[model samples]
Target: MNLETDLGGIKLADPVVMASGTFGYGFGYEGLIGPGDVGAIITKATTREPWAGNPPPRIAETPCGMLNAIGLENPGVEVFLSEYLPRLRKSGAVVIVNIAGRTFEEYVELASMIGTAKGVRGIELNISCPNVDMGGMQLGTSPDMVYKIVDSVKQVTHLPVMPKLSPNVTDIVEIAKAAESAGADAISMINTVQGMAVDIETKRPILGNVFGGLSGPAIKPIALRMVYQVYQAVDVPILGGGGIMSAKDAIEFLLVGAKAVSVGTGTFINPRLAMEIKAGIEDYMARHGHTGLHEIIGAAIL
Candidate 1:
């Protein structure tokens, strides 16, 4: 079976990719699985300057899912370019860097930097991170903001640009179409849903940020629905993910119109989840006599 596919101009060996944040800099789980075993590696969200992140209790476990307000903690772009970029390039895998910034200028700067950086194949603009006070989902909620940010970044970079969409919006299709119209090569859907947990006994909030993004099986149905909606709204490819824990779950995303599927919280549950899902897709393809992934992508629409 041919699992290879293209996300805009970037070529992926398969549709299974490790979501940003959960995969670190793309080398954290190197020993567990070979770089060639999966399609691409999306590194953690990096900012222009280093962020210390939130205070204590950044992560809390809830029923069937988890809540986190990690606040986009990272060593910043300079550290990543100087230290991590070279190592990831040597891994012989396609590397897609996920970037977030506090301002429009920072976003453009980050894109321009990564666009010329070696070993990077694509850029995933993280406009929907719900954990931070500035940037993140703030820039994602407004369709106008989405268009401007994406357009600015596109002007500076030739690499495939994907604006990750926020499910927190009233109409996700509007934002997806905005990104597409602004020259986004592709779009990724369903960043963690905004949620909160309470310590009823102590009458306190569980996370230090009070509210956090909810991820895991709890948000799968909602994510799938959004992907389907965005598929019909935009002409660009869709990278779909939310609470995908198994190959079957990934297939469900594919059926709904995702050109690729990202494994986020699922990686925490199983480090080898991406590889397992890749193998499972291959098996399913062989059994059903499907020659390539394109056969099942958006097959559910009819």
Candidate 2:
């Protein structure tokens, strides 16, 4: 089966990609899976400077998902380029750097820096990080800000820019269109839905940040709906995910029009989930007599 696909100008060997943050710079599970196992690897959300992140109790489990307020903790871009980039390049997987910034200038700075970095294939602008105060979902909630950030980042980087959209919005389609109009090459949909959990015994919140983003099976239905809606609203390709635990879920995103599907929280449950999902997709294609991914992408639209 032809699992190869494209996200804007960046071509992939397959449509299965590891979601940012969950995979931790793409080298954490090298012992379990190979670089060629998936289409590409998106590094954790990095900022202009090193981040301390949130306090303890940053993660809490829910009914079918989990809430995390990890606060975008990272070693900063300089350390990433000097250390992580070299290791990532050596792995031989296509590298898409996911970056977050406190301001428009910071976002542009990050793009400009990564644009020239060796072995970097694309940039996933993380405008939807709900854990931090300065950046994250704060900048993603406004359509105007989304347009400006994407536009500014585009001005500096020749790499494909994908602005991850937040589901916590009045209208996700409007935000998606803003990114498209601002020159985003592609878009990543359904960044974790904003949620929180409280401790009835203590009569207090469970997370260190009080509120956190929810991910896993609980958000899959809502994520699918957003991806389908954004597909019709924008012409750009989409990287879709949220509660995608298996190949069936990934296929659902593809039928709804996602050119690629990101495997996030699912990895926590199964470190080899990306490879498993990829194999399952190929198996399904063979069973259905489909030769290429395009044959099924958006096949449900009619």
Candidate 3:
């Protein structure tokens, strides 16, 4: 039952964590998986101010995946701290706040705020969000920008910083290395692939934003490949995501060197998916006579 893992200095009871955005704030899914059941609760992407998000048709179903343009509609950092943080502290889970900022100073400010917050475990920088108007795609796609953003936030906070990477990049390895060199404690990646859907009948785009990022089974292979390449390029821990619906999905990430696996679109399909994946991983380790999850990290390459 050694599912425990480490993300820099933060230790987790397991390698399964709920991905930001998909899990909403920490309070919504507590009924399905207790705060302690999974390794960590990565909250929704919060901005410096409240966002109304995009108009209707924010989400649309795809074959094996889904596209969304939720636009990071959050209650703002002040509201989150004044309201959400108090309830999250009691959930019995490690609170990892996922934050996005329009500029370098904003990110630094957000990180510093979270560092002083009592219940926060770490900060997962949501640098890959394409649906937002600010620094999501703008900062994540370029290695230099990624480095600069990570550097700015690292200077302000002592808490572990996990820079989430975008899949819509020419070279993920390059971005991963940039984040590592810029002082990122860990890197979470393959946020979403840029995509669009159209309604044949109306002869119009499906989502309000016209283009949304894709998630779910369709992007798993791409996510794994990025994580594997990133693992080879840097020594920092990697949090791999993008379509992990089952334990087998999670194992694929571990085998490729992900320190932990984050559940995204899968939670929409099954709220208890993280718990099921955790149990499945345990069952797998027992049957194979492998006693710990760490043993599987990068094992496939060996």
Candidate 4:
């Protein structure tokens, strides 16, 4: 419906947003999407320093989703703040820079950098980055670690903070509450679930990284469920991601309590997805006689 929505202190023109990692720097899809068409543009998950990322052949397709181990490749914070933000300043987009780190100190440092950055509206703490040593899913599975990392970032940044949750956890609600208590302004879920695909002939994992996060339509149901449960557990805003593509899919997230929903692999399939979903959501809202998107949060019946 009238998907004009607000999360935390960030005002969104519509509830449709571009997920991190999928949308590179704002300029990558410049000609494809109008800068003002969607709610926000979440840049690639950035670390404190530049990363070359995992080896090639880092993606594999599942029945309905895709597995990826991009290793959070980014041009480091300095380059992003100096070069990228200057270019994105003209895009008229609400830039929410997603920050990730291997340690609490790194998290605080990244948040400090963003707190002083000029062109960004908010910060997203990416606590779900699979650890290279802990087998990837360790950090996301614990409630205490979730709280500690969120607190570290929150203490350093004045900007609204949103923690991206991992769906690989046994209890997402517990982690969501920890984030809220740690002073996160909002929460976004679920990050890709850990998955692996095997090459029959090679008898080895298809992704060069061996294990990766699964995304696309196949993860929608699980994402929706996590959003619903997390929404029930906390009062802070929730931005749902993972496999949302169309307006109807976006609405499903809204109905499940997502203040906004982000498009990831969906954009890979169609660059114009943000515009299409923006118009489609508005039209759907008007037809349904909805004056605002807030009314739809948690509208789903068992």
Name the candidate that leads on lDDT.
2
TM-scores of the candidates are 0.96, 0.97, 0.96, 0.96
Q: RMSD for each model, in Å, please? A: 1.8, 1.8, 1.9, 1.7
What candidate 3 gets wrong by more than 4 Å, as runs, is 129-137
Candidate 2 ranges beyond 4 A from true positions: 129-137
* Predicted candidate 1 versus true structure: per-residue lDDT over 1-302, tens digit per residue: 79988899889989998888887876657588767777888889999999999887999999989999999999999999999999888888889999998788889999999999988999999996432445345789989989999999999999999999889999999999899999999998889999999999999999999989999999999999999999988899999999999999999999999999999998888889999999999899899999999999999985
Q: What is the lDDT of residue 103 in candidate 3?
A: 74
Backbone clashes in model 4, listed as residue pairs: 1-285
Per-residue lDDT tens digits for candidate 4, residues 1-302, read 35567778888988888899887876756577866877898889878899889997989989999999998888898898888888777777899999888777778899998899888899987887755545555566788888888887878888999988988878899999998998989898988988999999999889999989899999999999889888888999999877888989988998888999999999899999988987887888788888888767788836
What lDDT, from 0 to 1, does candidate 1 have?
Answer: 0.91
Worst 10 residues of 3 by lDDT: 129-138
User: What overall lDDT goes with each candidate model?
Assistant: 0.91, 0.91, 0.88, 0.85
Q: Which residue pairs show collisions in model 2?
A: none
Name the better of 1 and 2 by lDDT: 2
Cα distance off (Å), candidate 1, residue 159: 0.6
Which candidate, 1 or 4, would have the higher lDDT against the true structure? 1
Ranking by lDDT: 2, 1, 3, 4
Q: How would you encode candidate 2's per-residue C-alpha lDDT over 200-266 as one tens digit per residue?
A: 9999999989989999999999999998999999999999999999999999999999999999999
